[model samples]
Target: MKDVQKVLDWVVAEVGVPGIVAEVKDGGRSWFGTAGVADLETGAPRQQGECLHTGSSGKAFTAATILALEAEGRLSLDDTVEQWLPGALNVNGYDGNTITIRHLLSNTSGLFSTGLAPEVAQRYATRAGFRRHRFDAYTLQDMLKLAVSQPPVGAPGERFTYANGGFHLAGAIIEAVTGNSYADEVETRVIQPLGLADTYVRPAADISYPDPHPKAYSKMFFKDGTDLATLTAENWESLLEDPGLAPMDVTEVNSSGAWSAGNIISTTSDMIRLVDALAAGTLLPPAQHRHMWTTVSTEGGYWMPHARYGLGLFEFDKQATGGTPLRGVAGSLWGSWFFAIGTADGRHTMAVHTNTEWKSWDVLFKLIHAAFGLTIGA
Candidate 1:
C-alpha cells in the first residue's frame, strides 16, 4: 500500500498533475490512495474515493446497456442503424444501412468525432470560450447533427477510429428501441443490477460535479495542431507550468457534447465495480457476452498501441501491462482523465484518475506497473 502511495505522490510532486486518486482491488482486499490537492486554490486534499468526470469511460456502460438489451431480444448487434433511427446517419457519406451497433461499439463505424469540430472544440477546448458557454445545454439531436456535418472518416467497418459520435448515435438507438432516455436505460440495466451506487450520468445542463467531488481543470489545448501523444513526463512539468498553458478550473461546464459518450461521473470504487461486471460477464448471457469480447483491430498510431477494441472495452496488449493482458477503459474530457484496468478474471483491478486534462500515456504506463506489481499477489 505504501509503495502505491509513493507513486501517487510522485505523480503530483513530479508530474505536475494537480491531484490524483486511485483504487486497486486484489483478491479479497482493496486499497485506496490519493495525492495532491483536489481544489488547487484551497489546497484541499483529494478524497481517497471521490467522484470525477469520467469522460468516454461511459461508453462501456452505454455499450453494455445495448448488449443487455440485445440479450433480452429487444435488439441485435447486427441491427442496422437505419432500422432503429432512420435517416439519422444517411447524411454526409454515412449510410445507416451499412453501419451496425457493433461498428459503433467497436469504433469501426468510421464516423467523424464531433468533439474535433472547430465550433464544438471552441466551446470546451479554449479557455475564453469555455468561460463564455460552459453551461449551454446540447440535446442528443444537436450531437448527431454535429456528426453528419463533417465528412465520414472511412466506410463502416473499414478500420478503427475513436469516434464519440458513434456512441452518441448508439445512445440515440437505445432511446429509439426502448422509448427511454439512454441514462435511464443504462441505469436500469447496468447500474441498478450491479449496484454501482456511485456511478450516474450527468444531465446536459448539470455542470457541477456532485458533492464530495474533485474540482476539474484543463489547459485548453483546442488548436488544430495540438498533439500530446508523443509527450513524456519530462515535458509536462514545464508545459503545464507555462503561463499561456496554466490549467484553468472548468468544473462548471455542461457536458452535453460528450453525453452518452463521456458525461458519466463516478468514483474509483464504483468504476471498478462497473468494469468488473463487464469483464466478468455478469450483465449478459454467454452468447451475448462472447459478442462483447469479439474485437476489431485499431489502426497503428491511431489509438492505443496494440490494443484491440472490443464492444465498449479495450483489451490492451501485454506490452502495455508489463505481462498480463488488461481489459478496461481510459477516458479523458475537458478537465479530467480516468482509467480502469483489470485481468480477464476480474480478480485484480485498478481504477485511477487525475483532475487535470494534462495526460501522458507514458506516465500512466509507469503508474500501472507500480500499482499492480507490488499489490496484486502480496
Candidate 2:
C-alpha cells in the first residue's frame, strides 16, 4: 500500500498530475484513495466520488446499449447501417447502405476521422460563438449531421480506422431503432438499472462539479513551438465543438461532440460497477459479451499482443507496467486519465482516474506496475 501511495505522490509532485482517485477491488471488496489537488488554483485536494469524463471509454457503454437492444430483438448486429437510419450515411465513393452495425461497432465502417473533414471545421466555427453557454442543450442530431457529411476512407469492413464518426453513427442507430434519444436510452437501460446514481450521460444543469470533482488543465503548443498553460475552462467550448481536438471543457465535450463515443462521466466506484457488470453478464449476455471482446486484425495483419478492441472496451493482455497479465479499457481527454482492469472472470478489478492531462498515462503505467509489486522502470 505504501508503494502504491508513493507512485501516486510521484504523479502529483513530479509528473504534474493535478489529482487522482484510485480504487482496487478483489472479489468485489475494495480500497480507494486520492492525491493532489482537484482545483489547482484553489489548492482544493482531490477526493473520491467526483465524476471524470471517460472519453472513448463510453464506447463500451454504447456497445452495451446496442447489445441490450439486440437482446430485446429490436435490431440485429448483421443489420446494415442504412436499414435503420435510411439515407443518414453519405460517404463519397462508398455505398453506405451496405455497412453493417457490426462494421460500425468494430470500427470497420470506412468512415474517416471527423477531425480531418472540411465541413466539420465550418460547423464548429459556427458554434464557437456560444462558448459561454452550457453544453447539455446540444442535440444528438448535431453530431449525426456532422458524421453524414464526411467521405468514406475505404469500403465497408475493409480496415480498422478509429473514427469518432462510427460511434456517432451508432448513436444515431440507437435513436432510430428505439425512438428515444441516445442519452435517455443509455440512462434508462444502463445507468439507472445498474444503480449508478453518480454516473450520467450528461452534466448537471448548472455545469456544477459533482462531489469529489477534479479541475482540468492543458498545455497548448503553438505552431512556432511556443507553449502556454491555459485554464481548461476558457477553451472547453471550442474543444467540445471539435471532436478532433482535445477537450478542455469536460462537460461540453461529453455532452456535445464526444456523445456516444466518449461522453460518459463517472467515478472510480461507478466505473468498477460497470466493468464488473459487463464481465458478469449483467448488461450483456455471455455470448454478446464475448463478442464485445473480439479484436479486429489490423490492415497490416499484425495485432499487438497488449491491446485489442472489445465491443466498446479495450482488452489489454498486460498492464502497461508489465505486471499481472490483465484486460482493461483506458480513456483520456485533455485533463483526465481513466482506467479499469481485471481478469476475464471479474475476480479482481482496479480503476483509477486522474485530473491532470498529458501525464496520466505515464502515471497509470507506474501505478499498475506498483500494484503488482513490481519495481518502477525495472
Candidate 3:
C-alpha cells in the first residue's frame, strides 16, 4: 500500500487540493503527513499539530455529553425537547414538544437546518459573499431564527434532515440538564479524560483558529442560472473538473453561523483520539454506547453518499453491498473538509482533511481509501 505522505503529496500536486493533512493509527503506531500551503499569502506549508475547525465533527462530543448525562440518570433520549426547551422550536409547522432528544441526535427532528439555508449558506459559499462577511458575528438566536422561518423536513422520526438548529437545541438541553456550559461538560467528560489538550468548543464570538494552522480556501460557482440550494454533488463535481472560477481565501471566518452545531477546533491527532475512544466504548457505558452506535440511514445523497447518522458521529459506506465502513464524523466549514474514521472495534483510526472549501465528499473518500487501503466508489 502507498504510504500516507506519498499519497498526501500526490493529492496536493495531482488532485489540486490545497493544504492537506492526514494521519492513520493502528496498534499504537501512527503515520502523519502534510501537503500544500498553510497561508497562501505567506506561502507557508500545511503541517501536523496545527488546529482546524472540526465543524459538525464536534457534534459527536455534544452527543457524547448528552449520553453521559443519560448514563447518570439525568435525562432520557425519549424525553421531549419541549420538556427542556419550550419556545425554541417555533419553526414553521413544527412543534418542539413532539421532538425527542434522540430525534435531534439522529437528525430525525425534521427541523430546518439553517447551516444550509440560502440566507446563511450564501454568506460563506462564494468568494464575493465570503469576503463580505468573513468576520461577521452570528448569534445562536440569530441562526435559530432562520431555522424557525423554514419548514420542517418531516414529522419527528419520519424524516432525516441534518440541522444545525437541532444540535444547538441539543446544547441548550445540555445546559438545562447539567447547569454548566456545554463547553464545560465536554471539557470535563471528554477532553480532560482523554488528555486532548488541543480540542475546544469555540464560543460564537471567537474568530481565530489555533497556531500554525493552514489558511482554508474555498470555491464557489454554478452553471449560470442553477439554483444554489439545489446544486448537488454531481454538479459540484462538474464545477471542480471544469473550473472557470476563482477559489476564495477563507482562513479567518468566524464559526458563529455554526455555533455549537459545528464550531469545535482540534488537530487530526486529537481527532483520532476522540474517535478511538468513542468507537471503543470508552466514552460511554455499554448501554449508552450501544445507543450511540444505533445509526439510521440518511437516505439521501445530498452531502454524503450512502450516509448514516449515529448519536453524534456519522459514517458512510461507499458500496451498495456491505463495504468497508468509513466510520467517524466529518466536518465542512469555511475551507476545511475533514473526516476522522475508525472501525467498529475502535482501533485502526484514520483522519484526513483538505484545507479547501467546497471540495467534493470524494476528497474524503479517496483519503480514507489511501489511509486504510479500502476501495471507494466513484
TM-score of each: 0.91, 0.80, 0.90
Model 1, runs deviating above 4 Å: 222-244, 319-323, 374-378
Q: Could you give candidate 1's per-residue lDDT for residues 1-378 as a string of tens digits?
A: 787788888888887789899899988999888898889889999886587888888999888999999988999999999999999999878899999999988888878755556566556544566688888898878888887887888888887878888899999999999999988998999889989898888887787876798888887454433343433323324433344566788888778778878788888988888788788777788888889888877744166665788988988765545557678888887778898988778888899999886466655666666766622211
Candidate 2: 10-residue stretch with minimal lDDT: 220-229
- lDDT of model number 3: 0.77
For all candidates in order, the CA lDDT equals 0.80, 0.67, 0.77
The digit string of per-residue lDDT tens for model 2 on 1-378 reads 666788888887886666777888777567887788777668888776787877677887888899889988899988988788777674455566788888888878887755445543333323242243324344566766666565677788788777777888898899889998888999988898888888877542334456656776543212221121231223433333233344343423324567788778888888888887876666778778777777665433222234556677765543433554355666665466788876667767788877644443457667766665533334
Candidate with the larger lDDT of 1 and 2: 1
Better TM-score candidate (1, 3): 1
lDDT per residue (tens digit) for residues 29-80 in model 3: 8887777888777888878898888888988988998999999999999999
Best by lDDT: 1
What TM-score does model 2 achieve against the real structure?
0.80
Global CA lDDT computed for model 1: 0.80
